[model samples]
Target: MTEQAAAVVDETTVAADLVTQLEYDRYTHEDPVPDWRPAKPFAAMVGALLLQELEDASDGWLHRTLDADPELAANLGFEPDNPPSRSAISRAWSGRLAELCSTIETSARQIRQLAAERGSPIGGPYETNASEEPTGSSKRTVNRLLRRKARDLLDELQTVVLPAFELDRPDDLVYDDEELLTLEACLGVTGTAANGGAETYGDFVNPDPALDDPFYEDGPSGETPLEAIKDLSPTDIAKMVNQGAARVLTRAKPRLEFETPVMLSIDITYVAFYGEREELVRVQGAPEDKSYDWCYKFATANVVGDNVHFAAGMLPVGHADYHDSDAYPGKDKSYRVGDVVRRLVDHVNDVCRIRIRRLYADREFYATDVFSTLEQREIFYVIPARRDDRVKRFIARMNEDVDGNKQVTVKHDNAVYGPVKHGGTKSSTETTLVSLPPDEDRKEPQVFATNLDVNDEIGLDRRWAKKQINRYSRRGGIETAYSKIKEFAPWTTSTNFSIRLFHFGFAVLLYDLWLLVDFLVQTLIDVVEVRTKPRVTAPRFRAFLRREVSALL
Candidate 1:
């Protein structure tokens, strides 16, 4: 028992130190100490609250348990004769949450300082940069150029994008435009600080951004960079910030504005929660770590136009498991693929100001209600047909209708009023189904529900089925977007849903910025009509910004 207690003590060195150092008066100045009786230390109250947390016990139960169990009371810093009331513990817990957070923060800071002092490079344990020389310039010039470009990017993002999005900034927000841009860029560059990019960034920024450093020859976040960016007219400037993610999402598909007949791809991406299951709002799907199993889901909408892929809207999903609610089937089955589809589609159309030409989804999102919902919105959709009995019957009927030894190139289109319903789905009125039979050319039967009228009046012809199928294939871009996005994440094991959400939101923003940067840089290259090209790719730009952001951290 003594050996076990010692092991526990060793494991809880930081927590024990925290408890030992904390002053009683610091947490409870409002509750005055009586002169007649001496007050107990705040650690005892904290210990009591912790005991409640560990056991997840109710107030009355915890009060009884503590009084009855002498061992538990002693372990929790409570005397058997003079046990603290549950009310006193609750008040203390409520009063000192911020202080507790600060204590944790201080411990974290000390750990980071220790690592830094030990001369362990913050770029993490791995080498981030691929061995390559700077493009079209000396290493010194490239570093200097990166600093200038970063400041320019931030200035543009702040003055233009923030105003355009009409996003309200919290008054107490510590990270200003410059800082957020740096952070955002790092989020893009390192993918996430937890991913080692922040450490890499910190290494560079601390040394380079100073006046003495060769990179900041013209000082930091000042005039030279701004002056260089001024020649870009309102149209050019508009082009610059439009692609940057405004308020975590843009007002419209700026990159896809002129490029018409766009295909919007809807897909689910998962960010795995390492925390306790009860603490998270999770869903079932492949979350990288557990791709084959159920995990937290994020439904994202991506659009491809003129060779540029734009990540449009992202919605976090909530899931319902059947085992938990057999008694109440009505309550457990609210979150559906159709629900996310509607949300992301509405977001893109209404919030993003992009008129959807067609929406493409994968096989997992296959449901008659999803098709019905799209039809109701007058949105065209292409999804891999779920080979259900009803859909199989439809395909079998089409296969039988084919005449002679001729290939089954025949296309069938029908309006589904209420074909199959599930999850309390209402009736469908104008939903159209386009089905293609399996043949030697196309091995499997293809099915899609779309609002695209097949009448000859609107250039809809026999080839429309093949054309739409090819268009739906473009949804593959969202998969690549997902891969790129996951790279930018700051790895964490935090139980706070908000922290996880922020990390994801920031990563999305960074990925968008990367796409925009590549497009914009290439555009400028074309404008210059020179062999000289963009030296910094997304990864390299991130490497540069990662150093900048990490330094700030």
Candidate 2:
């Protein structure tokens, strides 16, 4: 080799000492590296990828950097004398699909075991010939598999899937461990807890050290994390994540404890963008602001029925196609909302094989398209009606029939409702508008529309429409899920939609995990006579997870 090339190779000698993430990626169905070819130090390759991530370098630039940059090569454990070729490094990344998948499964199983231990301690660690074998959770336990699904889906993104798309794995990523620890971090913040347990425990001996995090204090102090993460979001990663998460949830269906239909609550959370990247769409948040943020909106699909309250998927919103509603209800275009609901429902229904019992959305979602979609799907829904003259007339007529000094209620059985036409491209349909008398909290009477017939729907017992209207109030769980998810998310201000997407996705995953633990912990405590047992709080849970994560690094 020429002296110049030799000089370039000399700079990466540091790979000789450090260990790389390749080990975490390795699990034996027997080893694949043949002895005839000497093993190259992979740690340097790890360093190269890290540098590439932080710097968003082209492959050509990364090749040159690895050959010549001593600091970068050394940190990744490279031997400066023999750094890998660009082609060789590329091959290493592209061929790892099987290994990456294996790692995710392995990690997912570990999380399932940890969850089994909490509230339902199966036997401790199982030994080949020992007298005691680790026990599994009781067969009767509820939502156990769902808990596992949440962890598997959450961790797969950072560790297995994201790395494939980014050509690098998450630095310092933690997989589905600390079932109890996570319970403390996520549930501790929400202040929801149970008072008892199942008298079981899960324990492991000499657990592997957690993978190191290179983005935070755990990484080299000299590096800036934001600059390194630019290429992490490949074009199709978002769609993959959406499909993968649904797949995970779908797989858990056979293990479901009951046959009840699923209830989903969908809401769009508007996140403001502070960047000038031109794709930004205009979104108005809150009524008082003069100007809205150039923002990207995300739709959160959550399970809110049969007492389940975990988040499932978050779909990103694009430039919405809007048109004026018939007679101008002044509502935001309903077609976008309908389109999101239809797509999400079809996706989840295909995966989970469960019918939707009902859908609960906030008042802002009252677009003409939304109502038509719900009715067409035969999915019952309750959304605030546009408080137009027709709705007020319904309230006024109901009020006039009331006895003096007593407030009027929905006692009308054979009643008629004002019809409103709405939709775009798809033909318009009429929705029944029902007005609710105001309570102490909301002085203005609430007007809502629904397709539920009093005699036709199950559990529609109350002749007065209060019973149907009351179901919407039960949707508060999803609203609470949003607030707590934002609390659990790590702070980021990247203008890249992918980065923003990942941030939001990770937060949703964390929130779902906490809910699972919270549900198990709650059920364990809320039942029977053991209600005094201490419930883990959210703050304490956060601190517990933080300290545990730091220790892993």
Candidate 3:
């Protein structure tokens, strides 16, 4: 402790001195110091804590004191009679301040214990043999604190999602909306499917047998949440879940530190369905031997980079419900791949409040309409090209046996292509295409379509093209993210689109939280080398959440 830290010992000079000591601790620490600037002054929080300690008041005393008196708030260094919001105060205390307070108090008590042991008798003879133990929430491990804060942040999603479906907590409800939402996240983190997992968790937490039934099971006789969810339309459910994802992006945007505009990746994922194909269900093509062909498809837009792959927006990809006779009964209602990209881009831009600089996608997004959409938005992108006749002709022009391994690079700056819709008009886009030599990953040549500068004056700009191609390779993170998203997604056999959509969306939310935690942990350990590798693995985070939330129950 320095002189500034020593000044915090006296109760009369506590709050301001405590702030000084905090500043001292930050400045004197090694590299990678915590980057936190509280919204409220630390002095006000410190003074409130000290006041509660002196008066032996309950947890509600801080807010009550600030609300009942203004003079004291001003004296404690809050903006004249304008105390911080209850949430702000709670956030401030729940963060690093709590650790600092614990440290300071413990250090002072240890000093007193040392004095008593040495026969100095400071503070009127402290007992050396007395056990010093933390009680209640303060006794929780660091993992518990982290899980509590994460779940608290995710609770905001419920406030946005539930009302979108016109849901509220009824007295006779089997589980409150928050509990169901947390249960959804719990199922996702634990990699268990819905009903069985819910029943197991309920058995541990719910003491009353009547209320311990799985509330997510699909049935007419049960009063589970699925009963209410089954009433919502597919559009309503999609909108509600997307709103929840947008809220997550809005919350995560502030934590990102970027030197360039964010890079985004858009791709579609399929969830296999075994039951009968109902409304909102689309047929996914597969081999004749495969059992399940019908599936629910969802498109997600994710930020793709070193340590920041958050699924920012998501939507279902299916044709409009026109009639029971034919899938194409309604021409105008079907959502195309281009429409998915445009909606996700606009939604992410509006909600995240950040300009998207580049977008990357797999060959499935190699259509002319997709290229035209990205170009129109002026967002640079790289999409692996489908080997159509024109693309194959360009690849055939290259020497077959160049450099003994048939590895030769080719670039075409002006290539025109179009899409043939189902009995609809075709549209074309003029873009650049790059054909690369085979490498260790694959034996065949890889072609990519992009608006990036990949041209060399005489031949392929090997260096520049290689650098851009390496950036395109970062899109692999999106696939890895999808695999991990599945890890967080609960196994569900339900064919109801609403339940499936909610489960997938909530799993994405948990995945984003897991990435956020890893990024934060990296910032504390090594500020520069972030997202290089995960500091907190998925299993560890899931375990933490499961233990903490179960303990809460």
Candidate 4:
């Protein structure tokens, strides 16, 4: 037989075998299968391939490559007569994209754990064994399966793949016992407390030693009851305080108990981006007053306590002069800050059956309605009074009496005094200026207003009034929590889409969870890596990758 004729016969036989295999695969599956079930897995395989190369090639190029490669086309279950439509590929993504994200989050968590255990010089000392472990099994499984697929194809694409395309193993693959405990702490489930037991007592734990030292502390010269512990991990600090508070309440077993108050800080910031300089008219008649302009406003709020939270709620802007302006209706829409605050308050109240003694807010919460509502609920509140003419006059009067000394302290009863000014065009009301006592450096009098009247000479003492000021001053703690939310969570960024709101919320929750993990890791590090002082930065990512790789291995 001629060589050409023999080759043709062999090719025919190979083609026949391929056809037989295809038919068997399609027919053997009895599921209410898509007409393409046997071939469907092939589509998933190709989709994964596209994802791997997505960064480099255009979509068209990828499609063409798939078309040209015979083995790939067959593996994708593409028949000679029928090819997968672009829409089909696109549609498939919707079904699997979530799985991909879940995979990534899981991988990140696992890798962090592994890195903490092996790479960290810090020995594992912390651990958390909960009755119910946080559930992420489905996500982890999906990530593991996809990662395995990637590994199997590694050798085939080694030469073509760029170095950047290679995934790096996370540094936090292994977590010591301490790291595990930290994770628990961040999750708000670190230590177990006996419910209403004899051992439990209600007392705030003074974790920070600095709180005892007056000089080092930021506030007044007395030892503040709240201890300021430095160098402790945020997660650990939060957990320890919460757990201690919980235990204390359990022991007290009081008829009325109060849940620990979670503080959320809200702030507004504006950022402006300009491509080039733009001129603005200063006045219609004065050309000399013209100036160039570039500016915009971006307002955001950070709600932090055990977990970081955020909202894109509206903030009202109103002008006293323009009460009828059309812009006021839309631009000055009411925000839901009060609603959120109420919900938080309710949560605590329901859990502990104890009323929140007071909500501390800065001048922003000085709105009469807000104060009135809290008062109606029998909730005490300490909010800074807006510094209007009344406050200024009181300060001026005190200064005059003291021979130019700015400090003075006094008490007054009932009648509102000071300047009458309209704030936000709402109403014309008088602001009462009550003087507080002189502090160390300045004898100048500080002024404030409150509805509560102090008739008793001792009750009106400046020291008592100053205490109110100090208590409200602690509201700044909310700002610190806000900073952490923006710094650590990606969702807080303005660019995040609303579709991902729930996911972002979940991510923040996970971050809180990671903080607990970090506390445990830090504890372990203290024990194991203390001398070497090894540090792990991206513990979550590290734990995730390590877990996936371990599974594959």
Candidate 5:
């Protein structure tokens, strides 16, 4: 048995020092120490791992156990009311899995040795004898595996996924590969983030050599198919774009494992509109802090999970159709964000077939109508609290309370909403207001409004607050999703709302496929766990996708 293993088992008292030797062994190892720092104490994390080994529990059992039995957790050296979350443990384990497993193995041996010393040894050694070949051991093997996975994923995308994005065209204008040609052209521009007209395909992808098959004998001109696309209504384009996103998710869902009742995040994004086309002006809105005054607005709903992050639904905001402009004019009619949220939720439920567990939205969504909508739908939410006078007063009182300051940097109070006016009736909504410690990135202490229960006890308040905040941080992934989606979204200067919407939506479809490709590659690399970051980068995935698309031809 290793000395560090023996030391941990020999200590009878449960305190932080029980794993001192394990900490020493980590720093004194032959391999370079990891640059990552753990969120919880070193000893507390090690103790949890030991408990995990003892119980042989699943991934989320430890968190549930700790919360269910705080006294038992404290006896095991964890602070009462404050247990390390499952995600924290998983991250810590994955980051140092090789090192931690060795220590645990050594400790198991030491325990058996001590039992034998007392004249009754435990059973035979606890170890798996299975010898499976490492799939990712060599760079060549990894690339080969990745290519195979990519081919399978992309094949489905082409055959089943791309067809969902086909737009209706006049039969007289139709020809061989008309829909396929249009889809491929959009994808080509997206893959390279190219700007300008359909000629952007030739400028960026240079498809002359790649499209040399018989399908190219009577090849469509640069503006052959897409010129007709711009003639379609924005509603038609939006429907096709949404269908494409849903199709990719439906195809990937059976292959990938997703958490039950996936969490959803909705946020608004803007595309700067620079044009003098007066008729299209109705489709543009004034988004803040933009170089251009009029911009196209969009709302997107994305699945917020560790492994299965997919943008499932999208809505073109501030766009209206005037069917009867004579009586009910479209002049002063504006879109409500709360109504947008409701529609997005309905779209995911009815179209994507995803039952939402909770929603995390931007601060702009912190309105009474939004709260009413979510509460009516029975969906939990976490939104940044707007610093209105009532919330500001709470912050002031919290700052002056010295007794509360020493115990926890977090505090919570009930945020009661009106019996005033909601949804054409007098109604009320209630939620909790959480005041977190001053974030390093912000000047003011962070405050959030949530329907989730917050425990404000001595040892529990900090942990509960931190965990909630960490969960909220997952919403930031949607921003990253938008950024990566732009890499695949074709840049455009066209004032046609349909063309712009199609470009954005097609990019989202491609982005989801990229995530699925990376996910499949990850499964090939490690069947048992999911990594936070992708091994196959955006550019590499784009390369693989473009190659697969060419092969389909």
Candidate 6:
């Protein structure tokens, strides 16, 4: 046997001897205990083999060493006709696969010390612009194999292994706080520090607004370097513009108007996954038409009040009604939009504890019935009225009065109006717009309508108008989330519906997991950094604790 294998065997022998001595000592002290016994010889031998497998230079080292040793070979009952090959030893190891898996898992958990020292990869694959290929040679295969094995092991634990460990009480099987924490550590976040890392969202925030301003000039010769860079190609400019817009939309923003009651902001995104050719067929009313120009819609709602928070509700367009010719009439068929908005408002009232007074949306949600429904439910709403002839005339008159440079505040008479042009067809509408003061430089306009009395003092300020516009614009963030999912997560832009659903679910789960990891890492950092001593020495402190416990034992 190699020296390492011998040492492992010796360590097991010493542990068994120590256990025997401890049991004897306890017996001498009249402690009530069962008779002590050494581990089975075969078990000890198997453990030694496992240790050698981990420590040896290659896969077949222990098997080769065993084959050459006559005594060891004889002990294992190997004959001339059926000598144990390396493959046989490998099969033997496979027989204790669960034990091996457990050992590897334990070793992986212990390697957190090394991982902490090395640090994790900041940002996900999408965020970091990483290549699609797996990082290392074995990484892909090993992760796949490990995940498959882990699922099987979890099933076995739930169905067989856990039940076998019967106890006096059933409650013992329940996961305790520490066990749950360990599980969170294992399955929660896989990589990198959450915050304070190079690629964290906070890192993107420029402290000085002047540095971020596009118009800012330093010792100007009538232009900054940014202006000088306009000489670049159109393709480059387009790429930069697209990327810049994505960055601006995705970056987190601060909450405004804390005293305002929470309201739902619902918006619909129509994605044409299939080309327009197939979509035209579905629109032409062929039920059995297997074409693909279908429109898929997702509606997301965010609650706006003291703090902006995500509301857990989504509305998906039904395939049947979405493409039905009779329901959606002409080219301006946008009934699905109204349905999604109503669902979001209903969800907010049902799920959120606070009283929601108003619902907010852009001109897309300008249905007369929508306003009526809210009024019937005793809810107020501030939706931008669609620009029809009447609204255009009103805006023109107001523009003349306020001279386009200043905001024109006006109130609409509470009178029901007639059919107005929407999408394409005309629909009967009844709503009035009361314009709040608008900031010309900010380009934010506010309009409100409800059956309830308007608080003119709070409503007339340009700041309020700006805040409303900002709140309404925040709904666009969901588009960024969708883009991130399509780019980073397992999701694809493919037309296969089943695969698409799978990918979407995976993306959402991934986002949730990322949030969970961020929370854990932030909590740990806060505890360590804000403590009495330097938090940077936490790993050293942990090592010290382990050593102290080992010495005590």
The true-structure Cα RMSD of candidate 2 reads 18.7
Clashes of each: 10, 27, 1, 68, 0, 4
Cα-lDDT of candidate 5: 0.61
Reference-based lDDT, residue 513, model 5? 72
The root-mean-square deviation over C-alpha atoms between each candidate and the true structure, in angstroms, is 23.5, 18.7, 14.2, 25.4, 18.7, 24.2
Task: Give the C-alpha lDDT of model 1.
Answer: 0.50
Tell me how candidate 3 scores on lDDT.
0.59
Clashes in model 1: which pairs?
Answer: 122-199, 123-199, 123-200, 189-542, 191-488, 192-490, 201-546, 201-547, 202-550, 202-551
Q: Write candidate 5's Cα lDDT for 1-553 as tens digits.
A: 2354444443122212233234433533433334385345555566666555533344477687677877766755668788878886687567744576676656644544442222121211111111122556366655876776677655455554556555566677545443444444445434532223334333333455446454343334445555656777766666766766765565455445666788999988777776674887555656566678877887888987767678887877774461111222224445556667887898888777788888999887887667877888889899988888977876775533455542224444454553222233234566777776565576666778887766655556667766876688877668777778777776656676767776777777778877876776555556524455666788888777655554454
Q: How many angstroms is residue 549 displaced in model 6 relative to the true structure, after the best TM-score fit? A: 32
User: How accurate locally is residue 354 in candidate 6, as Cα lDDT from 0 to 100?
Assistant: 36
TM-score for all predictions?
0.54, 0.54, 0.66, 0.35, 0.65, 0.39
Q: Report, for every candidate in turn, its global Cα lDDT versus the true structure.
A: 0.50, 0.47, 0.59, 0.32, 0.61, 0.36
Indicate the residue-level lDDT of 287 in model 2: 34
Once superposed on the true structure, which residue ranges of model 1 sit more than 4 Å away at CA?
1-151, 157-188, 192-204, 208-257, 273-292, 319-329, 397-426, 436-443, 455-461, 527-537, 547-553
TM-score of candidate 3 on Cα atoms, chains taken together: 0.66
Q: Please, what are the lDDT tens digits per residue for candidate 4 over residues 394-433?
A: 5556522336544334445313322111223242223234
Q: By TM-score, how accurate is candidate 2?
A: 0.54
* Alpha-carbon runs more than 4 Å astray in model 5: 1-134, 174-218, 275-279, 282-293, 322-332, 399-422, 425-428, 527-532
Q: Which candidate number has the best lDDT?
A: 5
Better of 2 and 5 by lDDT: 5
Q: For model 3, how does the per-residue alpha-carbon lDDT over 332-412 read when each residue is reduced to its tens digit?
A: 545556667877898767755658999988777887667777887899998888878978887776544535654335565
Name the candidate, 1 or 2, with the larger lDDT value: 1
Error of 2 at 100 (Å): 28
Model 4 misplaced regions, further than 4 Å: 1-332, 336-344, 347-354, 399-460, 491-511, 514-553
